[model samples]
Target: MPKPNKLLIVLAFFSIYVIWGSTYVLNKTAVAELPPFMLAAIRFLTAGVLIFIIAAVTGQNLKISRKQLINTGIAGFLFLAFGNGIVVWALKFVDSGFAALEISAQPLVILLLMWLIQGKKIKPMSLIGVFLGIIGIYLLVNQRQVLNQDDSYIGIIMIFFCMISWAYGSIFVGKADMPSNYFVNTGYQMITGGCMLVLLSLIFNEEWSSPLVWSPNVQLSMILLIIFGSIVAFTSFNYLLKMVSPEKVATNTYVNPIIALFLGWYFLDETVTLQSIIAAVILLSGVYFINTSKRKVMLNRFGLQQIQNKLRKNKVQ
Candidate 1:
């Protein structure tokens, strides 16, 4: 791969750190006015189509084998259609910052999932992370504000399931048959996931509002979500994985929640509670512990490609 300029590298880091964090608020603002599934469907479909066009222009082959297509489809369903789509639905009830904070425990969830599903051993630090993660989640979800709100509990619970789906998808895609090129692979998943989201929207009978009738804020939010959230951030994430060390790329996991919390509070007037602040610290610390513990074992057991894929398992969202 050609070397990216320093400016470009900085911009890529900014995209994954800042723009990715901002996605929660962007989606929250849009989902307030638009059907969640439909909104996701449109965002992904347009992004997917644009990816294919870009691929073609760049002379990248868009073709894949039958098995690869099937695997990508399954990934699409898990990671995007259900994983991200449900989170968008849940955002209607929960604060964007709160959702981002809860999801930041992703490394913890992945660790437990590996232990339970693959029979992998959990090291001592990860075990500590697990304990902290559980406590943090208890504090986060047990809030009076969260429980008092209508359906917020359900939304919070559903977001946990989404985290699981995303984690599993990450593992599966790392080992599964996938396109060699990350761009092509993501495009295929986006298209497949977008189709599934459309199907889900139809099945759920979500009202399909026309873009023409959307409020200006919603229209801008959708544009931002599709362009910056889906495309630009993803491209930056992929680029940085090649240019930087895993630790640097992984810093986004920590920074995203902070950015989201601040943006949500500043933009949408979302409340940041004391308990939630404590939970955020605990949850993010758990993530750090989990990632720190797993680094040596992962490097020894898995090849570089697998490491990259596992790290890339996280979405631009």
Candidate 2:
């Protein structure tokens, strides 16, 4: 097999960052018309089938051991069932920017989980970053205009729970014995999780007929969700998770929120306040610290005084 190109890796990274970021606005648009769970089910199911067909043609084996299947199911439950499902529902009541603020805390959640479960210590700088992230969240949540716009405290709270679900899902994926083939594992998870979501929509008796009432704009957004958000973004993310550190992969959490914020502003006429800018900067800086601090430590241990030192030297030369 030919080695993967570096450019391809870079493109995948960018794709996940940009595409997933846009999902917040997309979700808001979609749920304006479609039931949240039903939308998620349809998105993932369609993505799963498309990928499955591609896999078949490419001769990618769909077979997985029982243990791997279980792990995939668990990941699906955590990631899709709760992480995504709850966020979609939350959008019915919250602004896309606010939703982005809440979910952007995934890095902090990952850090705390690592400390509690893996016996890892948080570095002081990283701790400062966490503090800043909290401050950012505070600014965002307390914004007076934002509060007046929707005033659904319950929806904000729901997004927090969604953050927790995503955090847990990320930790589970970090520890699970996943299959070697990234696409296969992703496909299995999406299929299982998507089925569960469909079942849930039925159990809740959510009116599937509501979709017919959606505006053409909402319909277009759903198409984007399935094609770009579900299929392209997820596949890129799973591929990166296999190729890079989980910490590195989760950096998208930070990047995505910024993209979502901008998209929300441009498309939804969502206002971006001074507070929003403050919060976004702090949150992303915290994510940077949390994700990269450990790498700096490891590099120091190996006698690399500065991780960026070589790059600087190369540029100077």
RMSD of each: 7.7, 5.0
What clash pairs does model 1 have? none
The digit string of per-residue lDDT tens for model 1 on 145-227 reads 88998989889999999988977776676567777776787788889999999999999999897899999999999999888
- Candidate 1: count the clashes: 0
Tell how far residue 51 is off in model 2, in angstroms. Answer: 1.1
Off by over 4 Å in 1: 1-14, 235-251, 296-317
Estimate the TM-score for candidate 1. 0.86
Number of the top-ranking candidate, with lDDT as the measure: 1
lDDT to native, each model = 0.85, 0.81
Q: What is the TM-score of each candidate against the true structure?
A: 0.86, 0.89
**What is the RMSD of candidate 2?**
5.0
Which residue pairs overlap in candidate 2's backbone? none
